[model samples]
Target: MPIPDDLHIQEAATLERKAFAAMESGHLAFRQGKISAMELFLLADKWELAEEALRCLEKTAQSS
Candidate 1:
């Protein structure tokens, strides 16, 4: 069955959100020193997550 265009948009948004959530988790883990740099690289690779957390930080710095 073909998905509707509206549904596709929603799905894409959901996927982007999921990616961002995963990146947020990775950021926290990295900050807490619970995960090493190598582990972070592996986690990001395994999940195919974007650098959403890093982007957020960059935006904050630019605005400030």
Candidate 2:
């Protein structure tokens, strides 16, 4: 496989940061009761943040 250049690495990092932000937003929405379980999961899935989403879900469940 070809090695990624600086620009490619930076772009990937930016995308990951955006995904993390969206996942955090989804968790915030969940805590605020503004979104249902289905909506929260969908939001994470839509943003390609399943791991973060699952982390948020599990954290919430543990808190409750």
Candidate 3:
């Protein structure tokens, strides 16, 4: 079984949006001193991973 292209694209877009939202929340938390620098760095890593995942999805779709 395989994921349909439309669904895959939608999933990728949703993940990317959530990743951006998480990054924004992390920034706000850091600015307000609610979170530490290390925590913010972790959130940044998450966003980077999301970006990489999106790129992989796009590449896979292109090949398909």
The best candidate in terms of TM-score: 3
lDDT tens string, model 1, 11-43? Answer: 556666777677779889999999999988887
Q: Could you say which candidate leads in lDDT?
A: 3
Predict model 1's lDDT versus the native: 0.66
RMSD in angstroms, all models?
10.0, 11.4, 1.1
Taking the tens digit of each residue's C-alpha lDDT, what string does model 2 give over 1-64? 5433554445555666777888899999999999999999898787766455555545544454
Minimal lDDT window, size 10, model 2: 2-11
**What is each predicted model's overall lDDT from 0 to 1?**
0.66, 0.69, 0.91
Q: Tell me the spans in candidate 3 whose CA falls farther than 4 Å from its real position.
A: none
List, residue by residue over 1-64, the lDDT tens digit for candidate 3.
8777887788789989999999999999999999999999999999999999998987777666
* Candidate 3 residue pairs that clash: none
**What's model 3's lDDT at 30?**
100
